[model samples]
Target: MEVVATLAGMSSSRTEALTPSQVRSARAALRALGRAGMAECDVDGQWAIRADASAEHAQSSATAYRCVHDQVVEERCEYRAGGVSQWSVQQAAELKANRAREQAWWDGLEAPERAERRRARQEEFAGLSVVEQERVKIELAERRVRAGVDEAARHDAWVDGHTMDAWVRRSIERQYRYQRLPEPLQQAKAAAWQRHRERFGIARGTPLATSRREHAAALPSTAAGRDEEFLLVDSGGRTTRRDVETG
Candidate 1:
């Protein structure tokens, strides 16, 4: 069961929003509500958390939110356990609708428009300061590393006979997660994931193509067929087959 908690209106009417510490405290409290299985929170529910004034006030409000969230969960537990819960049904429907809408929007874009958008994004990035550029680069690299690790885990799971449904679910979960990031970070994550896919040769219908190629390449060459002692075996999956000079 996935729990969605919204820190509703953390900002305030004041010129300045809540302090960083207060925001963190409030987020932590919201996570606690999620951990305790508050499946869905009402945006205008009877309970409210007004935390823009001070950190102490934010903490108190967070505690109050948690108490109310817990009570709501407890009240709904029996209905949730017995059959299809309203939250699950509603969430699934929303997800399906959102995906359809997004796909339609993407499909409606022309090639020239897409290319122009990409060029504009490149220009925007090039216009950033050196420090900002470095930050973006570092974030992109980290995302690629994370994606590689996740791909390896997925490959292992597939080898161990996990269902294809699990793989699809994991991918959808990742998509939903990065889509929620701020625009720049979201683009970086998406590009990193795209590069990860290319590195692993994950085509539309063949996710394991590169793995199979690497496995075939890893075998000793037909010309070098012998009881050769293996000193170092480096399987450069992306490079397929390359002779390494070992001194």
Candidate 2:
């Protein structure tokens, strides 16, 4: 009978499953053939059982053959099952050669040439320092001012050349008048106007109401006005416009 077993438990269970009578008979037959049961012998010498055995002993011989066959099949299955192999020396040597070639390529670059490239990059950055940036900003502001003046001149030329409506002329005149002031001065004047409106509780886009008395009251007492000019008042009151101007 042929027996099939998995590679995992083949060796242990196969030995245990062999009948005691069969083991004893196999041992006797091996001894009769001038072979020790547990001794190591050449594969060819073991196969010589067929030529030497009698008809009656043939069954025992076949049983021994079956045992050896199963052992060999189990070993071969275990070897192929894992799908692993050892690497050869030639493969390792090729890897080392490739690494050496890469290292040699890097070493061949000129040191002085690399340093020169680095220095050029540093010099380019040095030209963009804070002071250099500030000078560039001032130059740009001057250029912008000049360009605005040129644009205004062109616009005025166009307005004078054509007969524009009254409203268009007034709008253009107002824009040009505002543009004539320096940018910083224009910003300061706008901030002052906003403060003045807020303090006097005036609505935006409404004209400020001012009589002669109100105008004189708002101005300093140094000039002649309707308001009474007091003198020698208390410490807090002395700080007023009347005392200061009189003093």
> Best lDDT goes to which candidate?
1
Candidate 1, residues 32-69: lDDT per residue as tens digits? Answer: 55444432345764333333345565577799999989
RMSD of 1: 18.2
Off by over 4 Å in 1: 1-83, 118-208, 211-247
lDDT of 2 at 100: 69
Candidate 2 local lDDT, 15-69, one digit each (tens): 4564565555554545555442323336664423334545556777788999989
Best by TM-score: 1
Worst 10 residues of 2 by lDDT: 1-10
Question: By TM-score, how accurate is candidate 1?
Answer: 0.27
